[model samples]
Target chain A: MANFLGLIQNENMKIYRRNSAKVFAAILIGLLLLGALIVKLNAPEHPTQDTHWKQSLQQQNTQYQQALTQMKDNDSYQNYYKSQIAINQYRIDHNIAPDRQMTLWSFVENATPIMILVISIFTIIVVANSIASEFNTGTVKLLMIRPISRTEILLSKYVSSLLFSLLCLVVLFLFSWLIGGLFFGFSGGEAHLSYINGAVHETSWVLATWQNYLLDAVKLIMMVTLAGVIAALFRNGGLAIGLTIFLMMGSNTILALISQYDWVKYVLFTNMDLNQYFNGQQTRNDMSLGFSLIVLAVYYVVFLGAGWLFYTKRDIKA
Target chain B: MGINTEPQKQPAVKLEHVTKKFGSKTVIDDLSFEIYGGEVFGFLGPNGAGKTTTIRMIVGLMRMTKGNIFIQGHSVKSEFKQAMRQVGAIVENPEMYKFLTGYQNLVHYARMIPGISKERIMEVVKLVDLEDRIHEKVKKYSLGMRQRLGVAQALLHHPSVLILDEPTNGLDPQGIHDLRNYLHELSRKEGVAVVVSSHLLSEMQLMCDRIGIIKKGKLIGVETVSDFMGEGEGKVRFTVDDGQSAAQIVKQKLSLDAASIESDAIELAIEHEKIPVVVDTLVVSQVKIYGVVSVTQSLEDRFLEVTGGKSVG
Candidate 1:
């Protein structure tokens, strides 16, 4: 056990001191920060009308003239009514763009899921490929003959990969936060929205500070584990990363469009996102956080268990 | 074959009918061998001759399909932890973190062994003669240097048995010689049983007390250096004046009919003690001894003979 722990420590030291990992980390951080800054700075400005009457008149006149022409030719009041209402709504909402700070905060809030997905995919590829690359490099044979059991060696590797994935996510989060904070002040935490239709009403609940951040981190870490396990089982880094993206994206898009199945909601990424938990709301189908957690737990267990079995039995051939 | 009677004497390592197969391919076929305390045992075979497979099984890297391997009477399968406690091995290559320095690699492996002291790390570094370069990253070291560092790491725990598979594969001649002498000293002075597998027959012959020859996934022979060389007489070849006349005279006068005459030399297979008798016979026949040389068969020749000159792989 001590030897196994020593191996994990040694693995961590390699990641920390290796120039390639450092360079890769730096590049990821720089790219993420630059992306955040660019998005923040180049935000589309909200139009403020100095000539509100002129603007309103121009928009209304165009729609009215079109409506009058349509009514004169086909005598259709339906087209006139639709055009008049749409034109009036457009004029009012055109100059009513969201506040700059609010827009940026919303952008970040939406982008976090994608960013976590990207980092998770990258972490899985890097960690999984490192292990597989040892075989290609003929290093695994060297590792196995070290008077230690194969199980301990592989477990140490898995633990090291988890640690590395966490490190990468933390870096991504820190840089994203720094850029978001610098460009758009951090005063948008209590953001919310409300919608009402007929007798139905819905509210966008604000996220609690700790629960939001912690759950997001946990989900991201779990995503990394999923990717890592896929890579380990397949022993193809690119395939693992690509499959993770496909699975996460495909599950939400395809499953959401299909007929609403109660069980499908549990497995789909739309519900997998813990942001709903922070939003203090159930999913469209009213799936609970506990159900989502259970689904994720099942996936995590099966993936890791399969990975462990395959890795232990497969020959460490290059 | 005598039963070991010493009160505390124990075999360093033992394997019985250890067979391992990968799918349809049989790697190690009923292999059995033992290394006694304080002897350097050479496991000689060509590439893919199951040397690595056997070593992996012994080290608990790969489980055997049949039979058992024991380290100091601890079964590798059931008592792997206890078995590994007194065993060390470098199977295919030196497994070290390339980014870590040689010293750090040694320290990392040292810490894993429960009772290993920090002082032992320094001791192994010096033992492998890598103290000067220990601080440099392993990736920066040459192949030979890396091998030495690997040896240092393996020896950190001061295991009673050390198993190395082709430890000198990537080393230069000087490095090979250095490692050979170091391993020799380790076995002799430290009383550590060593099993070193290699394709380099001459180096093994020089260092090993006993050589186990494997061919086609099976151990063909296991014998001491002198025993495997055989008790037969060494060959002596000579070029003498008037070899044809001498052959006729020797065949008639001294019953030298078995002596075969080549283009330039008359060859006589004679024991070392009979060299003088052959010389005297030639002189008595008025045949001048132009040249006389004795040829002893090398381990390579012996191996070729035992393996029937077939590729072991």
Candidate 2:
């Protein structure tokens, strides 16, 4: 176990020593600051909050109730209206007013989607290059001739790539929180309201935001894993990077076109966004959270299994 | 047979009928050899004779289609860690991470194994004479410096079996000389079995204690430095007067059936002691003899002769 940790340390040294990885980290930080500045500059400094938030929420509830009644025949799409109505009714009963001003947590929530995209692109490149560049530079010959097994070496590289992504994720979360607090006042409580099982529950915004970031990052995990495997099996960094990025950028379009088919739920992209269930959305009627989880697990195994088998068993002529 | 009671009696690396094939095309065909401790063994062959392939298999970088390799009595196929623990190699080139400093590259490999310390890393750095530029990135290093750094990386673990494929690829004359002395020192002082592969015949002649000549994936001969050079034997030539009659006298006296006269000379394949006898016989027979010279065959000539004149890469 200690040896394995050393291997991971070795891999981390290789990853962090490269200039490209540091540049990626800088880009992520720069983008977060840019986002904060954009939001700060575009907002009205002295904007007044509406004092009648309860009344407006009540009025919004009535409108949602009316829409629900009119759309009773379309019961399949009623969860959206039902969730909103339950949240508003609970807010009124509990005397919790809806946020009318930007707060620290809320700004972080706004930056999640865009920053996640940048982080995913950066992580995919790191993961892909980690495996292929050894072969390209012919360093793999020396690397494999060590006392360590290929399985351990490959696992170290695999884990380090994910570790890099996790580092970026943590940095994104913390930096956005800091920037958000500085730009928008930390005036609101770190409480988030959610409607589950027909009840509105209050939860820690920290936990909720972390869950949100990680759930939205399901696609990133899948894509980076794919990239790592492709790089290992093909031994081509550029091909892996280009192919994985193309698939990531085209995932939504590809998912949309294939959503009509019955087997679409089994496709990797269909199950990547595990957040759909939490958000009261489903791409298919049969895909529950459990089903998506199972699908992702199977693909996760296949990708890593193929990569491990090839890395350990295939001859390294390079 | 890398198992013997004596510490230096057994082979450090033993390959038993190792074979490798790509699809139906065999790359390495039924090759077998043993390199013992305290000797510098040269693996000599022309290009594409599976030298690199055999090195890869021994290092566990490639799997053999048949047979097994053992390093210090550990099977490479089963006890890989134990086998590799006894070995250190640079398969083709000393291709270190270009972005990493020479020190960092050493650290990177050191971390893969247990019990390698900063002092040991520094020791190897000093051994390779890379202390002045150990902190510089490998991309800025000269080819000779990289080769030295590679040697440093390979030596960090104190391996019993050291394999260097074309170790003189980019080395200058001085660097090559230094490396030759270092390898001899390692093999002699530490009982390390140093396996060196190169196409430079004279370099091999200078550096090797024993040489194994391979061709087309089969070992044609494995001999000690002296034995492989045919024991310095060549045709003894006699530049004489009446060469035909001199040759007739030598043939009649010494049973030299193949000795013949050409260009007013008679050449006989004989040893040093027999030259005096031939001259005495010629003089007694009243045949004039002017000069007697022995034309010794060099390693290059013997290598070309053995390999059918295909040039070594």
Candidate 3:
């Protein structure tokens, strides 16, 4: 166990020492700060005077109803509008504030998807190069000749990649929160209002945000594992990163095109977005959170299994 | 076969009929050899003769198709970790993480095995004479410096067997000399069984105590440096006043084949003991001999002779 931890430390040292990794991290945080600044600057000069919660809620309901009537053919947009309308109606009926103030929690909630996208891209690049660059640089021989088993080395690398992804996620969340709090007030304990199961439900902002972050982390985990498998099989960093990013960015379009098929729900991308289920917006009527979790579990095993097999059995000729 | 009589201590590295096949094409045939402790064993072969392949198998980087390798009494196939703990290797090239500093690379590799102390790392750095630049990033290091760092990393664990394949690939003359001296010192002082593969016969002749030559994926010969060079009869070149007369007298009196006679010299293929008799016969025959030079065959010549004229790369 100590030896494995040492290996993980070694892998992490290798990752964090690289100039490119440091630069990538800095750019991610800088982009978050910039995003927060833009949102703060775009806020209304007199938020409380011009935009009352009750009045804004009523206006948003009317606008959603108008858009819903015009977009009857679009099922996804209709579902989104219906959920928004339901949430607005609930807030109006219960006399709950519509969360007009941009709090730190709100900024985090709004930026969750963007944060996931950035972290996923960064992790995919890091994980893809982790194994492939060893071969490219002929350093695999040094690693293979060590006293530890091949499985241990590969596992350490795999775990280190996820740890790096987790680090990025934490950094993004904390930095966004800090920047948002500095610009917008750290006030309000507004609950996350959602429309689920043909009714309205309210959840704590922290709880809902944590669940969203966890689900987003799952998508990044799948991408990292897929990148690792590709890197191990091909031993080319460029190809691995290219393929993983391509799959991640094209997932929505690919799912839409293939969603008509019954078996498409079993595809990795179709089940990646666990947040949809929580938001009462299932991309497909058949996809539940439990079903998506099962599909992701199977894919995670296959990706990691194939990667471990190829890595342990390879000849390390380069 | 009965050269060293040290009560036959257990060999540090032993290969039993090891064979490696890459998809039906056998790269290493049934080859067996043993390297004892406190000796520099030179692995000599031409290009593509399976020297690297054998080294890879010994270090467990590449699997052997059919056979077993034992390092310090542990089988590499079954007890890889145990076997590898007793072996250190640098195959083909000494590639390291260029992004990391030399010290960082050493520390990273040192963490893999247990009981390696900071003092031991410092000792190895001193051994390889890299203490001056150990803190610099590997990307800024020269090839020779990187090679020394590799040696230092390999020695950090203090393995019983040290395997270096083409270790002198990119070293300058000074670097190669230092490395050769260090390896010899390592073997003598620490009793580490060092196995080095190289194409430089002169360096091997000077650096190795014994050598094993392979040809076409087979072990052609294994012998001490002196024995290998002195296996066959040597050539004796006699520079005389009359080369033609010396040749005639040598042929008639000694009844030996005078290999060549050019200008004022006659060369004959004869054993070392036969030189005095030939000299006496030539003196008695009134042939004034100015000089006699005995030429012993080099390892390159013996290697060619044993491998059927195939040259070492």
* Candidate 3 chain B minimal-lDDT segment of 10 residues: B1-10
Off by over 4 Å in 3: A47-78, B1-7, B169-178, B238-253, B259-266, B276-291, B308-311
**lDDT tens string, model 1, A105-216?**
4545555666666666556656666656566555566555445666676677778877776676667556666666666675554333321111112233233222444566
Isolated chain A: TM-score per model? 0.66, 0.91, 0.91
Q: What is the iRMS for every candidate structure?
A: 2.8, 0.8, 0.7
lDDT of 3 at A154: 86
Which pairs, if any, clash in model 3?
none
What's the candidate order when arranged by decreasing DockQ? Answer: 3, 2, 1
Q: Which portions of model 1 miss their true places by more than 4 Å?
A: A1-5, A44-100, A103-108, A146-149, A186-223, A234-239, A249-271, A274-288, B1-8, B170-174, B230-233, B240-266, B279-289, B311-313
Task: Report the candidate with higher DockQ, 1 versus 2.
Answer: 2
State candidate 2's DockQ.
Answer: 0.78
In model 1, the clashing pairs are none
Q: What's the distance in Å from true for residue B52, model 1? A: 2.0
Query: What DockQ does predicted model 1 obtain?
Result: 0.37
